[model samples]
Target: MPEPIPSFAALGSHPLHPMLIHFPVAALLGLVASDLGYVLSGDPFWARAGLWLAGVGAFGGWLASGLGLIDLIAVRRIRCLMTAWCHAVLAMMMLSLASLNWLQRYLAAEPILPWGLYLSLLTALLILLTAWLGSRLVYEHAVGVEAKE
Candidate 1:
């Protein structure tokens, strides 16, 4: 078996990128739910909730991505993995969509309509794809996994 790749962007032995990713993933996925809630119930509360979720998701995703990028750049073994590249690309796409979604809601007086909902849905889908690729890196390639003695 190949040797494990350690995370350069780590707090001691814990990878910062993986640790920080969960909040943004949850927030982005929750944004879709909020959008659907608004669509079904026509509630302004859901729209407002979606606004916060999008903002948090986009911002938090960037922060986590930065750490991941650091590891990708610093670790030659990680850079050699196709799964890491795909995960990075998909994550960038998802973050872009999330930023646009948040911007739409922030600028428009009445948000969470056809465009906001659509963007939310698209971003959510990308999140799933990106997450899958990331999981493959960890579980299959053992990126960031420490070797046992």
Candidate 2:
């Protein structure tokens, strides 16, 4: 008989969906924090870092989402589909926003557009909600984690 395939659970939560997620989480959070800094202090540098962090987070978000999706699929759960969909949509949104933000900045080396402030805020909120859904999907629904009794 063939050897049984290895399971992600063996590696633990960090690598599963929680680990490797800090980049995007930190990026998005940093975007908001830095944006606030910019607003409070009017420091162009902080604003720049915030925008760059959004771009960085978007890239990491894409990878994390991909990993989450893959694990979601491999584990196979109804809630996972819903959770994945939520995360996927928001992730795409975040990625697009970050891309647009970076493109605009690259073209002009400027701070994020004024409206972008609101958009990033919304994106961060959605990402946070998506993260919650992901937790529900795994911890509550046993989607990506091992099947429970």
- TM-scores for all predictions: 0.97, 0.74
Q: Name every residue pair that clashes in candidate 2.
A: 14-19
RMSD of 2: 5.3
Among all windows of ten consecutive residues in candidate 2, which has the lowest summed lDDT? 1-10
> Where is model 2 more than 4 Å wrong at Cα?
1-15, 78-80, 146-149
**C-alpha lDDT of candidate 1 relative to the true structure:** 0.93
Q: Tens digit of lDDT per residue, candidate 1, span 1-149? A: 46788999998878999999999999999998999999999998999899999999999999999999999999999999989999999999999999999999999987888899899899989998999999899889999898999
Error (Å) of candidate 1 at residue 38 is 0.8
lDDT accuracy of residue 121 in candidate 1: 90
In Å, residue 36's CA in model 1 sits off its true spot by 1.0
**How many backbone clashes are present in model 1?**
0
Give me the candidate number with maximum TM-score: 1
